[model samples]
Target: MLEIITSSALPVRHGFFTRKGGASSGVFAGLNCGTGSSDQTEIVAINRARVAEAMGVDAGALAAVHQVHSADVVTVVGPTADRPRADALVTAAPGVALSVLTADCQPVLLADPQARVIGAAHAGWRGALDGVLEATLDAMEAAGARRDRIRAVIGPSISQPAYEVGQEFFDAFLAEDRDNHRFFTHSPAGRYLFDLPSYGLHRLRSAGVGHAEWTGHCTYRDSERFFSYRRTTHAGEADYGRLISAIRL
Candidate 1:
């Protein structure tokens, strides 16, 4: 069976799928839905099919983007033959599921049930810093969703304890805003432990979302249930799986 995490805050049908119930094996095992990975194309299709079924949509109705860690947001009305180079998707159309692939990056799902609009975003630190979450909110509002009625939930991602950063990384955040220093703390190894989820929540709240929260699941800490890019690098693995998170109107 698939292990899908959900939040009561969102009135729409949505889930943050874990790395389970897949046909893949080896490094890209367990629901590796990233087509960009070296995982077999057929296996990735099968895994995505399973997710689409779970979301009550045909496999082709499940829409995604070619994520490039930018703040770009696409307003999707239907599935397209070509995946746009974007980091987030929003839709008011029923039966169309917006999804994002992540391994330790924030998989953020947002919805305005009253407006029947939903969005999904892949927010790594770079994307988050570049205003991807805000851009998602903007796109949803453009699709007729209200900022004050939107509720957002961030799925499993690398927690601060597992996300150590060098001085340059810390410097970049400070360059954006000195208040960003609150998102980091000194680590025992003399590096900085960046609080990515907390930063995500801060961005959503600052953008005027009605509600925003993190699921409190750490991808890097739970290897069995999640695929963590940092963990894969730490283990010197050739590649890693990608977890899929989706939301539907």
Candidate 2:
């Protein structure tokens, strides 16, 4: 009953899970898998368990990190006591699911089935600019994945039409690289709209990955199907749910 979005480019078992078919209620309604949220811990666990089931892995085999939004990537050797404070995970181990939690931020899944390597990452603007995507590729290569065979698919994210940012945000990107200007456009409100997915794809492609794509589902625009941090803030909600995406080798 879970709404899972997948891409044909990745031969491995992976899914970009939607905020549907979950046990949460109130503001964190429908599949809030983030344990750091105000939602009940047991409920979040149940949601994650469902994801693990969908990925055909044990609950403990679904590995994730604390997600500090940096370029950090962790290579999953096996189950660990502490979730390393990182935003990405890679694994060559079969039966282990690399998962990332996101709300509007990009949930990127990468796979190179021939090399038996897979990776999942949580990429926000800061994380993307900091090279999280490239870092993930590096970690996967370290785990035996071949860059040319790896396909990266970006899941639900806030599209440019819905992502209005101030001049400062625009300036931040420009400061990083002048080419970053191409990812922004002037909105009707005299602000800038950033193309998050395009930027993500750009990063992935620039890193020399064989293929990169976006699901084209805008998280902020699809309330019933996704969890959007910006949407929740726009509605003045107390808290927002987090969506989960996973990949297994």
Candidate 3:
């Protein structure tokens, strides 16, 4: 069975799918839906199709993007002819499921049910710091959603404890804004641990969104349930799987 996480704030047909019930094997076992991974293309398609079925949509109706880790957002009208090179997707039309693939990055789902608009985003540190979450809201508003009426939930991602960074990473965030210091804490190893989800929520709240929250799932820590790029790298694994999150109007 598939274990999907749903948020009360988003009263729509949506889910943050865990790495459960899939066809891939070995390190890519359990719902590895990333088409970009080295995992067999056919297997990735099968996993994505499973996710579509769970979301009550045709396999073709599940729309996603190339995810270049930019702040770009695309507005979807129907089944995509081509997945655009972007990090986020928004739609007002029903039946079109918006999705984002991530390993340790945040798979953010946003909705304004009152306006029938929904958005899904892939927020890695670069994309989040570059304004992908706020850009998602901007696109939703353009699609007739109200900022104050929107609710966004960030799904499984690396937590601070598992995310160790060098001085340059810390300096980069501090350069962006000094207040970013609060999101970082020194570790016993003398490195900084970055709180990715907390930083994501801070951006969402600062953008004036009505509600936002992290699901409190640490992908790096929970190896059995979620995929983690960092964990994969740490283990010297060849490749990693990407978790899928979706929201449909």
Candidate 4:
């Protein structure tokens, strides 16, 4: 069975899928749906297909992008001929599922039931700091979504306790806004632990979203279910599995 987390208030069918029902084996175990990984193409396809079925949609209707870590948001009308390079996708059209793949980075799902628009974003620290959440909200607004009516839920992601960063990362955030220092805490090694989920919620609230929350599941700490890039790197693995999150009207 696939462990999918759904937001009750969103008024849409969506899930933050865990690494449960999948075809991939070995280190790339569970539902490793990333085609970009070294995992066999056939296995990745199979995993994605299972996810599509679980979402009650055709595999082709489950659209995602290349996700180049930019603030780009694409509007999905129907299945695109190709998955463009974007960090977020929004749609007013029902039956077309918009998805974002992540390991420790935030997978944010946005929906405004009244406006009948939904969106998904792949928000890492870089993308979040660069305004991907705000960009996603803007795209949803363009597709007839009202910010005040939108409920945004952030899926499983790396929490600050597990996310130790160097001085440069802290400096970069401080350079953006001195008040950003509130999102970081000094660690024993003199590094900073960053609160990515809190930053995400702050951005959503700042964008005027009616509701925003993080599911509070730390990917790095839960190795049995979630596939964390940081954990993989810490364990010296070649690559890590990407967890998929999707939303539909």
Candidate 5:
């Protein structure tokens, strides 16, 4: 069985899928839905098909982007073969599930059930700093969703304890806003430990979302349930699986 995390805040049918009960093997084991990975194409397709079935949509109805870690958000109306170079996707069309893939990055799912609009975003630190969450909200609004009525839930990601950063990384966030310093702490390694989920929540709240939350699951800490790029690198692995999170109206 698949282990899918959900938030009651979102009234739409959605889930934050973990790396479990998949057809993948080796380094890309367990629900590795990333098409960009070196995993067997057929296995990845099977995993994605399972997710689509869980979402009550056909495999072709699962819409996703190429995910360039940018602030770009695509307004999807129907399923397409083309995966655009974007980080987020929003849709008001029913039966079309908006999805995003992540290994350690944030997979944010947003919805305004009253308006029947939903969105999914891939937000790593770079993408979050670039305003991907805000961009998704803007796209949802354009699709007839209200920010005041929207509920945003950030799925499993690298938490502060496992997300050590360099001085340059801290400087980039500080360059954006000195207040961003609050999201970091001095690490025992003399570096910084950045709080990605907290920053995500801050951004969502600042954008006037009615509700925002993180599922409090850390990908790096739970190797059995999640795939972490940083952990894979630390373990000297070639590649890691990607967790898929989706939302549908």
Candidate 6:
């Protein structure tokens, strides 16, 4: 059984799928659905098929954008004949699942059950700082969702304890807003530890979201259960798996 975390507040069908119940092996083990990865294309298709089945939708109904770490949010009505290049996706259509892939970076899901609008975002440091979360909310609102009725949930991501940053990286966030310092702490190695999930929640709350929470799973801290880009780099691996999170009305 796949250990899919769900939010009770979300009225629609959604899941923050973990790296379980997959046929992959080696470095791409356990539900590596990233078609962009070096993982065998057949394996990725099979993994995505499993996710589609879990959502009670056909594989073609699972819509995902070509994420490029930007604030761009595309409003998808159904599986497009051509995939668009965007980091976030929003839709009010039923039966179409909005999916996002991530490893360590935050996979943020948003839903306004009352308005029947759903959104999924692939927010890394660059995208988050560029306003991907806020962009998603904006797209949802454009689809007739109310900010006061939307609930946001952030899935497995690199936690501050496992995320070490250099002075330059820290300075970039500081330059954006001095208050961003609250999301970082000094590491023993003199590097800075940044809390990505907390930052996501902060943005969500500041956007006047009805509710926001993080699942509190660290991608880097657990090797058997998740794929982490940083962890793969630390181990000198050629590539890493990408986790998928999806939601549909």
In model 1, the runs with Cα more than 4 Å from the true position are none
Once model 5 is optimally superposed onto the true structure by TM-score, how far is the C-alpha of residue 115 displaced, in angstroms? Answer: 0.8
Q: Tell me the alpha-carbon RMSD of every candidate.
A: 0.6, 0.9, 0.7, 0.8, 0.7, 0.9
Q: Model 4, range 42-121, lDDT digits (tens) per residue?
A: 99999999998988889999999999889999999986547899999999998899999999999999999998999999
Which regions in candidate 3 have their CA more than 4 angstroms from the true location?
A: none
The top-ranked prediction according to lDDT is 1
The global C-alpha lDDT for each of the candidates, from Candidate 1 onward, is 0.95, 0.93, 0.94, 0.93, 0.94, 0.92
Candidate 4 off by > 4 Å? none
lDDT of 6 by residue, 13-96 (tens): 999898899878889989999999999999999999999999999999999989899999999987754568999999999999
Q: Quote the lDDT for 51 in model 3.
A: 98
Whichever of 2 and 5 has more TM-score, that candidate is 5
User: Could you give candidate 2's per-residue lDDT for residues 18-136 as a string of tens digits?
Assistant: 98999999988899999999999999999999999998988988898998999999998886546989999998888788899999999999999889899999999999999999999
Q: Return the number of clashes found in candidate 6.
A: 0
Per-residue alpha-carbon lDDT of candidate 5 for residues 134-247, written as tens digits (9 for 90 to 100): 999999999998999999999999999999999999999999999999999988978899999999999999999999999999999999999999999999998889999999
TM-score-superior candidate, 1 or 6: 1
Tens digit of lDDT per residue, candidate 1, span 186-236? 899889999999999999999999999999999999999999999999999
Residue pairs that clash (backbone atoms under 3 angstroms), model 1: none
State TM-scores per candidate.
0.99, 0.98, 0.99, 0.98, 0.99, 0.98
What global local distance difference test value does model 4 have? 0.93
Worst 10 contiguous positions by lDDT, candidate 6: 76-85
Q: Which runs of model 6 end up more than 4 angstroms from their true locations?
A: none
What lDDT does model 1 reach? 0.95
